[model samples]
Target: MTTQTSTQAQVIPKFGEQKKAFSIDKLKRLVNAAKSMSDFDQAKRYLCSYFIPCSNPHGVFMWRSEIKNLEHILDKNISKLICSITKVFYT
Candidate 1:
């Protein structure tokens, strides 16, 4: 006798087929606003959501793929913003 659990697996949704409520631009802006604020809890909330697998699954994969994948999605202005923000917070 063979018991197979085929339907138990969660298939990854298509790249563009995720819910409309999930906005990449909104997330980026939230991260920026969070970074500007002085509240640790608020900032942590935004950043953690972006970097964590639960909220931003693609983000975790992109971050894991290294700088190339991230840079490709970031574009010129976003890259600049990231650089500026990092300079402010990291150094």
Candidate 2:
């Protein structure tokens, strides 16, 4: 009896060819939409500034726990804001 083994080749994706797991523009739009919510100016500003492309003197600093609190005021869907910010900043 003879046994044969088959080998498969692995393919690596190039930088440009790699598919993005998330979209920055989409996240920015979502943040902007969240900013439009009424009665949460401070939270809005904090969240918006987090997305600023230019140098931020104020700095981008937010506690993970704080995100939980802000999510209540900003969005009904908890994961929307959290996931976007986490993916953009943490990753």
Candidate 3:
């Protein structure tokens, strides 16, 4: 008796566009949108260059936790922003 094995190739999806860095204009638009919303204060604090102190020690810890969560969300968008900028300029 003889046995034969068959193998198949796998296909992957391509982005078709090149990656690029985020632009100042895009960042400005995001900042503007954030400012216009009710969460502006919290967003501003998260984006601020200087650290803001919380009234209570526990408040400070909570702020840090919230910031960390925000960072996780923002990080994903940041990648998309960069890709968009790259496509705009290069393509």
Per-residue alpha-carbon lDDT of candidate 2 for residues 1-91, written as tens digits (9 for 90 to 100)? 2111110122323222323332446445444443234423433444443332223333223223333221112224335544644212221
Error of 1 at 48 (Å): 7.4
Clashing pairs in 2: none
lDDT tens digits by residue: candidate 1, 1-91: 2111221122323332333333455444444544334523333443333333323323232232222232223233344333433214653
Best candidate (score: lDDT): 1
Provide the lDDT at 91 for model 1.
Answer: 31
Where is the poorest 10-residue window by lDDT in model 3?
A: 1-10
What lDDT would candidate 3 get against the real structure? 0.29
Query: For candidate 3, lDDT tens digit of each residue in 5-89?
Result: 1101212112212123223473344344442344244323333322222443322111123233212223334445334322121
Candidate 1 structure, TM-score to reference:
0.24
**Which regions of candidate 1 are displaced past 4 Å?**
1-20, 36-91
Better of 2 and 3 by TM-score: 3
Q: Which candidate has the highest TM-score of all?
A: 1
Give all candidates' CA lDDT scores.
0.34, 0.33, 0.29
Which residues of candidate 2, in runs, are more than 4 Å off? 1-37, 52-91
TM-score of 3: 0.20
The alpha-carbon RMSD values of the candidates against the true structure, listed in the order shown, are 15.2, 19.1, 18.8
